[model samples]
Target: MSDGYSLTVELTRGGDSNNRDKMRATVEADTVDELREKVDALRDEMQEWADDFRNIQPEYRRELPDDQSQLGEVQA
Candidate 1:
């Protein structure tokens, strides 16, 4: 029998505080190694998409908070 793994990924774009995207998926594999490989592949795919978006739309790229105090608050 295969084991099931649950993965949740959240990607945020733009300086807007509320703009965010979330994805959840389940992956099944017969071995731990296979599961890890599958999870890593999915993570890499999402990262690639994020990089492309950031490159294509510089205006929508995420900005770091200016001050340390701002870090305490949630940002998109």
Candidate 2:
């Protein structure tokens, strides 16, 4: 008598079920509607993370010369 539903998924690239990654979890709820709401919330949180990751940028700067003689003076 299980009160919750269990889900197990395996992902394979080349049709080899044995050589794949697996994820298993159980969702507990009083009703099917509750389960759907929980799953949708999870989806929304994942989407937020994806949106944040898309905004990454690199900072760039030029290195100063180690030798003072090699450095050039700035013009006004």
Candidate 3:
């Protein structure tokens, strides 16, 4: 007979703010060492994803003229 071990891992980015990202995985192994290895791999994957996410730039909307009468004027 053999023993089985299962683990669940969750990683999150920007936890302090409203915009947040999360990653989760479940790993299983016959030994504690194997379980730890699987969890490490999952953590590495999550970290890579977080690094990539950090490189992305936020989009902003273009601002319009504040004066309503100037809206009809053409630019040179």
Candidate 4:
């Protein structure tokens, strides 16, 4: 018996023309725990892409919380 999952993640470019970014990947594992590990790895990769996008477009970047949460919230 074999257990595995095939998933696709998509992202949209923010600009004049909207373009699609498609990422197709597969995770093969014998157990659920192993599958979770594989999924976490995939999630990390997606997060890196998001970080890169924020870096490229300063206007769409999200503000980070500072030591003074109240002040940061107010500024935002």
Best TM-score among the predictions, by candidate number: 3
Candidate 1 displacement at residue 31 in angstroms: 3.1
Which is better, 3 or 4, measured by TM-score?
A: 3
The true-versus-predicted C-alpha distance at residue 76 of model 3, in Å, is 12
lDDT of 1: 0.64
TM-score of 1: 0.45
TM-score of each: 0.45, 0.39, 0.64, 0.44
lDDT of all the models against the reference? 0.64, 0.52, 0.79, 0.61
Candidate order, lDDT descending:
3, 1, 4, 2
Per-residue lDDT tens digits for candidate 4, residues 1-76, read 3455544455554455443344456666677787788878988987788667556633566555665555435653
The numbered model that scores best in lDDT is 3
Poorest lDDT segment (10 consecutive residues) of candidate 3: 65-74
Q: Which ten residues in a row have the lowest lDDT in candidate 4?
A: 13-22
Candidate 1's C-alpha runs over 4 A off are 1-3, 14-26, 58-76
lDDT of 3 by residue, 1-76 (tens): 1579998887777855656777778899999999899988888888898898877766976666666455457576
Q: What lDDT would candidate 4 get against the real structure?
A: 0.61
lDDT of 1 by residue, 1-76 (tens): 4255544555566666554444455556667788889888888887887777656533566566676446558657
